[model samples]
Target: MSSGSNSARRVASLLRPSIIDSGVCRSCQETIGRRSYATATPAATESTTTPPVVTPAYTINAGVVLSRPPQITRELEPFEKAFFFYQKRLNERLALPFTKYFYFKRGTPADEDWKKKIQERRTAARDIGKYNAYDSDAWNDELLLGAEQSEPANQVEALVQDAESTANATSQDTSKKEDIPRPYPRITEADQKNDQKSLNRLLSRTLYLLVQSKEGNWKFPTSPVETGETLRLAAERTLSESAGVNMNTWMVGYHPVGWHKFNAPRAKKGETAKPDASGSKVFFLKSRIMAGQADLSINTQNLKDFKWLAKEELPQYLNTQYYSNIKNMLADR
Candidate 1:
């Protein structure tokens, strides 16, 4: 024990200068002989806690505007120039400028005077060497400022003669249904705006006279104006529901023009049919179609097929009075 104590004192004395007296503190000196002083480190008695992680540095500047983010989920259907016809005048009337189209049902009054006006216009177009233009591509930008041409006097004799014959027939038989005069001349009318692509992929706006199907159908996509609805809204709803009009297809152009009226048979079922007096009035809204592939899947109306045709091509497909009605409203760009 005496020899071991003497050896420990000698080792402590040797470590005193370097571990305690020269640089190391008093606590290190006390541990020199008891434990190895090879490398200095924090004591084993230290806590088991981990150091906190630092975040990436960022600086917000003063006066930097922080706009609120847009709500993507609440995005609504767009209207007008916001979606189509990027180069149109604001507040300007939207005009597709269709050739006014109409057709008389069988047993309806046929006006020959109206026929003369249409023939005149067709002749005038041919006289001007615009026969090709009559069938060619156009933007329908024609400035038409005059009143519609009046029906000619030539048909007055024919109308009176027909009336006399009808009167004589009625006088002969009071039981005949045709003897009673109708409040309105039964007819059906439609706007015929045609859309098709030219050879160069240019969009064409030719007018067409669509033929009625075998069951007597083919009418414009239209509906009655609901209560508290504006004309524009009603037209929009009608076109959307009846024609599958989508935002990408057409742009609603202007306030509706005056309503077009036509007559029809009563909607009553399983009974003797009556005249639809006060006739059906359809409000027209001119619209520019951006493309042709319209979603024509109307579940409610009977529409079989459609095609776009120029006005010159309509003579073979349309009745004379109906063609006359269209010609009176026709203009050129």
Candidate 2:
């Protein structure tokens, strides 16, 4: 052995066993004059995650707004009559004047006949109390100062008598009379008797179908929504079930017109509330009854009665809050 190798062996034999027995490797630990040791490191921890929240479910219902559209025009009020008359006159003034020559040639037999008819027709202003002193005969009454025996007065009286006689003779002859078709009466026997169920009652105004449940509550036909059915489909089915399939009806649209939320029924004293008694929501769809009437006998919901009523008459039959919610959906006439 060389002298250097003998010195290295002497230093290793002098080191303590405690320094060599340390957990850290020899490369990690420093070889200071006083033996040094490595410190232990802590292990990493895993992160925790939070779960998602769930929403509560609500019961959905579909309802129908079955209505009978007005067949005849609604009666006009006196004010409305005057307003329409004024508007008609204003429109007439703005309209292009009729060209007489285009329809009837000048000085022909047809033109002569037209001129005679025009002379016999009285001005509309005479009936409505409208007159222009500068344009028309402002004094509608006959001349009071003129002698009754005047030749012109006698001629006018004769002409008037001849026209009256001809009109009277035509009216008296039954076989020569024109066969003019008259309209069905606005008021029916059902209307006279106040029969609520009859569809023929109100001819002029719009009529809504209101069904009375076995509990005596009046409402539009409605039913719970079934799985796999849309709101519109549910509404269609509900109407057929509640009002019967006899009526020919058409839904207005696929979307709902309005929605009303109903609260869960309150439990009585000493009674437990049902678990699935969550409040329901009703979405209404507008529909029109084109033909046939509601037959309550075949109603699956056990509806006791029904009515075809006008919008104005609904308040008398339905509750205030319920009526107010649906008032806008109903037609005025």
Candidate 3:
């Protein structure tokens, strides 16, 4: 054997068994006169595992300013007042053929806005293949809430102008008495007829409560239930953020009236879904405004419009089953 290899063999033979058992090897310990510092090293791959996602202790949506909770006063209980109002309205509904009575102001700018709204609704109905209201062509003074008339249609205006022209001419060439204009009501008569038709079309669909979202989609204000919060509490948060300017005026039913379950579509190739395969579930509690006026200033700051809609009226705006739930909440049946 070579001299170096011969020396290595001699040193290995002289090594004590105790030295090896103490985690020291001949090449690293005896040769260096001491053990080298060492530790168990994890594999390279073990260092690169994905970290867990951390959720916040309290959850809330972005840009949402939490409002103060409602104050219960020494006054009447909310449920009692609501029940009384409900009973009164219900009695009025049963007493008349028309379940609801609407009063409109006359000769105001609001009248024009109403007219525009009616026209818009009619156009939408036509597009959707739905019929307008009953007696849409009616022009009687009683049917118009005392406004009594509308801007006459072009055809009616043309006829009126022709009648006036006939009245202007001497009665020699045209002796037809029916075509003559004498103390007859002007364009308003024709306008009223057209307006009645428009109003009928508008009335075909019931008024629905809707809030226009930032994306321009119409939906109710909704939010996630926070930790340590009840469904009613979460619902109150949502309401105060969206519709109730005075958070103190809002009230909620203790139990959930309905729920909406949402699941995201399956991921496409090379894509991964969110951590939770089941997306989310939203429970809706029955709610009411206690004393404040309906305000569009709070939750609607970024929105265009919001309205308080009756249950049956939501069919024009919401999914069928959702509409049914709302209907059940609002009516006897």
Candidate 4:
């Protein structure tokens, strides 16, 4: 072929448009629709020096350029694009100072009311503290000032002053008084023997076994009746307070009653054994579990370990030292 003809054919081939149906055209059409049309001229060259056609690295729509080209890199799904627009609008709204201010004080009035109430409460508490004096000198001064203002010559006034002075003196004396120590009861030899017999009888009585946890340890809830409270009440309260278990009904059986005394070497000097005081009372009381009485409050204050065991399993469940009582109780049952 002639050189001019060959050159003409090459230019024509490069200029010819690639065939594109609706689907392929739609992809490019969307980007073209959003951008301003530009006329780009093909450069003329004879030595095959064709300048590269620089297509957009990203898709453009309505003057908006995507960072990553949706058509070429990764096309965004409709939902994804919708989400992007939503996030874009959200960011734009957040940038506005008015929007920020509106949200900042949205519930501020209610919060302010709460803060005001708290301040008022604090003020009242301070006022109460101001009235309650801790210093003895301040209290005495107030009392004396009140007394001095009274008419001393009048008999009624003198009487009132005397009463006030007496009351003040009593108050001061009461504040100075030492805490009274509880005196241990004295047990005579006859009483001790009687108590021993009573204890033996108590031991022979039936007792319901219940385990409770206290201070990370397990302790049997047993007590002798003394002072004001009954044995049953004492046992129940001790169990409840220590192990969180409430004893409802007891199935008392034959239990041994015994009295045992030990001279505690740890007792302080001059601390003689008081007569009429029983060393210990051992008794058995039978009881049953009550529903809804199980303590669910988790506290290590009084107890730590706990379990309920049947009479048959008592030997295996309890330590060896506790077996004798369990065995006797079961035999009695």
Candidate 5:
């Protein structure tokens, strides 16, 4: 062949794709076709490779939202009180008349007593707003009964007397027995004295446990999560160790309720910082105390004081940031 024609054939071979051998199977040719895309270019290779991202290490801790649920119903708002009062009146109007004879046989002491009481009360079933007027005559106290000649001059005073008299009689005849049990007052001595440590205080609101550290920082009971320990188990251990074993408590669930994270404290002067210290992460688990109280006297965490405070009171004791972070997990009432 001529030198120019030989050079032209070499250039054509360089531009064309390689052909599969005629002897090769269809499958082998298909495999070879796929291998063509694997040819690497500088831009393609650089685009495909990625440097692994490194996440900073954190010291994991578990905390407990140890709380005492409300022992009594929360105080009703004015609107709520009116709503309940309306409901009670509506229910009373809808109810069938009480058949006293059916309950107590005729001519017996019970029947006689019922009749006497009914006569004394003289309150109609349809009486909605009016207080029991005749109920006041039953009381022996002359001072409460007022003078025989004198009468209440003001309409408000008369209504007040009627209401008081009705309440006294109704309270006495609430049940068949005279020895009906009365509930203890919601306000206890601990509440009056503002004793934060006492469980008896704040009976109508959920109370949380917060402890003051030796450094004067107040927070929920927390401890480092040990190797192979779950957040729940760590929280349980933290409560028992830091708050003492005197409390009777149960974890709400296995899963963590909430979490808080913060940057690690900067190393002090002359102190070598830890290589692995990046930040701190705390996972909180909820718990409820059924009985007993926290005794910090035997705790190993060097806690100075503890308080069982309601959610509204937390802002005064805890850091603003910390309170804001965990406030969603607390009971508002």
Candidate 6:
């Protein structure tokens, strides 16, 4: 073969064809074509291309972003549709009909059977003298006296033995001689003068009754008793420091000391335990303002507000739950 032809053949062998016309190999094309008479379709000779479709990236409905198409129809089961309808109806009926129905059923008895049963039970039970009057014997005595007395008898004369006795016995229960009022405890002028020194000594030890304030969330002022200080001393100091008011007269009444106990969660074990809690003793001191004394200078920094309320109006202002103790204290005063 010529050198030019050989070079051309070698180049053709190295290059792969863009498409194959048949299943037969190019190297054994003539031999296969002769042996197999069957024909095969040829593959595509070049790359295929198609245009891309452009769809929306997003949709908006009433300013809300939507990434998918909205459904044209909602699919719900028969029972679900019925349940939704029933719920809507129930809500509407609840406004009036349901409440009325509840009250009607509660007020109206089921039948007359229950009422009949109740009446039968009541009749079967024993009759006790529950309505018997307490002063029946007294009324019988008056009636008997009326029959015996005939001295131009009036209603008053018949019921009573005499006008004085009737008035005393019925009005004031002063039938007993001891029921008469006694004279007040008297102090002679001489005794009073002699005991003036002793009275002054007793008054010096007396503590005053003062309240701090009950404003801006009511809270009682309290202070721990200092060394060598008594409970009375602590109360006096607390009142003085908080309200700037000094008390000279200690109240002569048994003041109630309210106490309470509560359980709080323990920090270490995550459990609750009872802790002792107690309230200060509230004293009812019957006191008068000292002559020429100025208005109390309240420590506004500690107490938000302060007032000296009258004893009579205290009940209306005080908490009803704590009124019992306060009332007893005031009563004693």
* Number of colliding residue pairs in model 1: 0
What's the ranking of the predictions by TM-score, best on top?
5, 2, 3, 1, 4, 6
lDDT of 4 by residue, 263-309 (tens): 22344687874433333334434444433233426423344444443
TM-score winner between 3 and 4, please give it. Answer: 3
User: Residue 89's C-alpha lDDT in candidate 5?
Assistant: 42
* TM-score of every model versus the real structure: 0.32, 0.59, 0.35, 0.26, 0.61, 0.25
Every candidate's CA RMSD: 30.1, 16.7, 25.3, 39.5, 12.9, 36.2
| Candidate 6 segments whose C-alpha is farther than 4 A from its true place | 1-224, 245-289, 292-301, 331-333
Itemize residue pairs with steric clashes in candidate 2: none
Give the distance in Å from residue 217's predicted Cα in candidate 3 to where it truly belongs.
3.1
**Candidate 1 residue-wise lDDT at 56:** 22
Q: Which stretch of 10 consecutive residues in model 4 shows the poorest summed lDDT? A: 61-70
Give the range of the ten consecutive residues with the poorest summed lDDT in model 2: 125-134
Predicted structure with the largest TM-score when compared to the true one: 5
lDDT of 6 by residue, 198-289 (tens): 22212212212223343543223444456675545555565456545543433222222332121233446764433332333332223333
277: Cα error in model 1, Å: 5.9
lDDT of 1 at 102: 44
Per-model clash counts, in order, read 0, 0, 3, 39, 0, 0
How close to the true structure is residue 29 of candidate 5, measured as C-alpha lDDT? Answer: 66
RMSD of 5: 12.9
Q: In model 4, which runs have C-alpha deviations exceeding 4 angstroms?
A: 1-219, 223-226, 243-280, 296-301, 331-333
lDDT of each: 0.40, 0.73, 0.46, 0.38, 0.75, 0.35
Better of 4 and 5 by lDDT: 5
